[model samples]
Target: MNFLTLPERTSGRRTYGLTSVIDLGTPIRELENILSDYSHIIDIAKLGVGSAYVTPNIKKKIEVYKEYGVKPYLGGTLFEKCYYQNKIPEYRTYLQDLGIEWVEVSNGTLDIPLDERLTAISQLKRDFHVIAEVGSKDSDKEMPISEWKEEIKVLLEAGCEYVITEGRDSGSVGIYEKNGNIKSDLVHEVMKDVDEQKIIFEAPTPKQQMYFIKEMGPNVNLGNVKLNDVLVLEAQRCGLRSETFYLGERECRLLL
Candidate 1:
């Protein structure tokens, strides 16, 4: 069972090289089946938006993720929903009761003031591992690279274990243009300015994932990856795919 030398990657509960999968509404049995085979590559399973609020057997689902060693957290949009309704205290209590260890602090949709967002990050850091999100979900609303860097810096300082660049599930906002093109210049600027290890770029599409992998190597943290694309993305990360063959350490004799 000889294997080709693939691109280097970290495994076993990694922090930097993460694949944060979005769970829209996968049934518990289906989730278990997928995790049974592919849990090794999955780092985080984010129950998208407010699905956690209405999901039946939600605790059992969280336990499934935990058993597989995948950190499960509610999406930032749910945080926004709670904040909008002025129920953040209730949200915290609910998360604690659910035994959820991770929290996402984001204000993508709501106009939560900057100071308040940072305060929330700081407060949540005491009881949970916070992953704050930067940038807006709105395609037309773009934050300048300078602002992005500053915001990322402060969020990390405020106690966020990681900061997600909002490329939304649609892959047509935040880091990506409305046409789903990566804002290459903006990406490069932020990469140069921020600590790349702490940034999770939300790359939902294959093309976007390819761009980040090419630019940031195999260890780039990516989020909003679809469930089915997990294996496909892992293949690309290891250079098993044609698009990323150049990333392999050992040259292929066929090409030579």
Candidate 2:
């Protein structure tokens, strides 16, 4: 047996493994091809932002994604938009009608009060798997680490299956600095209070992905991955193509 194969490769469909692609505007056929070839390695595909609104065959798209064993959900921003327009109940019903089992609850763009957010979480839990996001879209509106930690606990208590750290599409705002890098100390503090298994780090950059895999290990849950980077990110997690192999070896040496 090869020593390289000593550790069984981490499987997909894992809540804390591999890539979660964000589908901005890929043609349905192209999306199907990509998922068919790489679905075993891609955990989730998010119809990024409001892309779901423009897709004519939303049900067909969801069915194709589900056929490949990939979980698909509308972006958090879309959910916020629905909530702001006072169409949340309709939104929830519409998604249910579309056969969507997962939904993202976030207030990145809107100022949803805590009570209302909790209510949404509680109600959505009855019909769907809820993934709530913590953090704001505005770069200047930084959420205090203490507040983030508290909110994570509250959301989890209110029935959220996973809590995502906001990184927008650019990964420059939210938990990251203006330079598009994760604030390691802040991540460390957040991890201290929240269960890493239930926390999805929105790491869109390779450097940020490497940082999280190095700092939090390969099994750390990552989100907002670009559609093209699914295979690359999976390779990183498996130590097949990334600096993570060296990092893991160094960690082993340190332990020894």
Candidate 3:
């Protein structure tokens, strides 16, 4: 069916308007189905937390994402776990053996100081594309907006391809409040101070997703999206969903 052109979303292995989906040990066949149907919109497939450490047919799953042009990587949580276990050397070797190229260096759960985290990103940069994550997973741990801006800027300088603001898979903590609502002012402040292109906001819920879409336009990078929500997010990106149906309106574009 022919339809009006939707707002132009970045196409072909997008650098923006990216949807980084979480894969929590989806069976190989099921993963294939998702990629076959929505690979065009799926930029990064993260094996959730430490699922990559235990998922069966792990290599095949990574290969499937690559075959469909979707970059796959282990979750930053897994990297934190490896670091906590003092097995980073083995972890790097494991990723290398699997032929994975992208990696997330996060301190969401751990209390690795800023300097050490930057050092890790610099060292990891030698072997893989690094995407660092900021913000604590603990909702009570409030970080000043100025610090958020500073960390994001420095992480980019330290060789991180992008820095993720942590709104976890549960839609609580980090960029969100305890009840899962966005800290809109904080989001705005960060955008004003940092490179929006290199910041991926982890919006795991439909409401949070729409908020980012409306506030940042369709090309704002998003992360921790559920596998099933890929097409839904794409629909919203193109103004196909009711929540953002007016996105194609000239008034909306003017706001951006």
Candidate 4:
């Protein structure tokens, strides 16, 4: 358990290199166990799409996360669902009741107008800390890189706390191909125009995560991480695992 030699990591808070884990209705006992062991590394627990509405004791779930110092919020898809159903006002009021502060605004599934969606970002920012998602969820409906960059700029300017590069939980949409390969060219161009620190790359796969960690350093914000992979991610970030083991001291040795 001694990680004194490990690569340094910031405490789990609203900080850089943040790890956002998806709370997929894990049993309370199991959830407690995991949190007890790793909550320090977990920044946010996103109640997966529509889960906050259906999970038993949903409010208690949020309390459990907070008790462990892990912030919780509903997924962006759920926000889109409420917005499409004409219940955004009701939903927004209910968020405070649920004790979650991080709000996600996305148009990945619905046909929301670009101006209206970005305007919503501005409106929502007035009340909540928003994480705006930029990119279509449909793999076939790819947006041009130039347009994506502009959208991210507009969202950030609209008061979004961070821009989520839509790589859905499946790792098959948004910034990734259907096979989970990253579109490096598109990502590089977007990063050139946007602040790398303000981005939370949707990296569901190990390779995808490593790609960003290697490119942006270990603390680059990453999201849609499965609940169980929190520690594994810490390992990769510290080069304690194979994928990034070379990152540990290879350069130091080379310099020597």
C-alpha positional error of residue 202 in candidate 3 after TM-score superposition, expressed in Å:
0.4
Of candidate 2, the 10-residue stretch with the lowest lDDT total is 1-10
User: Please, what is the TM-score per model?
Assistant: 0.96, 0.93, 0.96, 0.93
Off by over 4 Å in 4: 1-6, 12-14, 248-256
lDDT, model 2, position 216: 75
lDDT of 3 at 92: 89
Backbone clashes, each candidate:
0, 0, 0, 1
lDDT (Cα, tens digit) per residue for candidate 2, span 50-94: 889888788899999999998999998889888878899899888
Candidate RMSDs in Å, in order, are: 2.2, 2.3, 2.1, 2.0
lDDT (CA) per prediction: 0.90, 0.84, 0.90, 0.85
User: What residue runs in model 3 are displaced by over 4 Å at the alpha carbon?
Assistant: 251-256
- Candidate 1 colliding pairs, count: 0
Task: Please provide, for model 4 over 1-256, each residue's C-alpha lDDT reduced to its tens digit, 9 standing for 90 to 100.
Answer: 7734555567636568899888778888889899999998888788887788888888878888999998788988899998888888899898988878889998899867779888777777788899988888898998999889998998888888888899888899988899999999999999997888889888977888899887877788999898899899988988778878766475446554
lDDT tens per residue, model 3, 147-222:
9988898999998988999988998998999999999999999889677888899999989999999998989899
Residue 84 of model 3 has an lDDT of 94
> How far is 178's C-alpha from truth in model 1 (Å)?
0.6
User: Which 10-residue window in model 1 sums to the lowest lDDT?
Assistant: 247-256
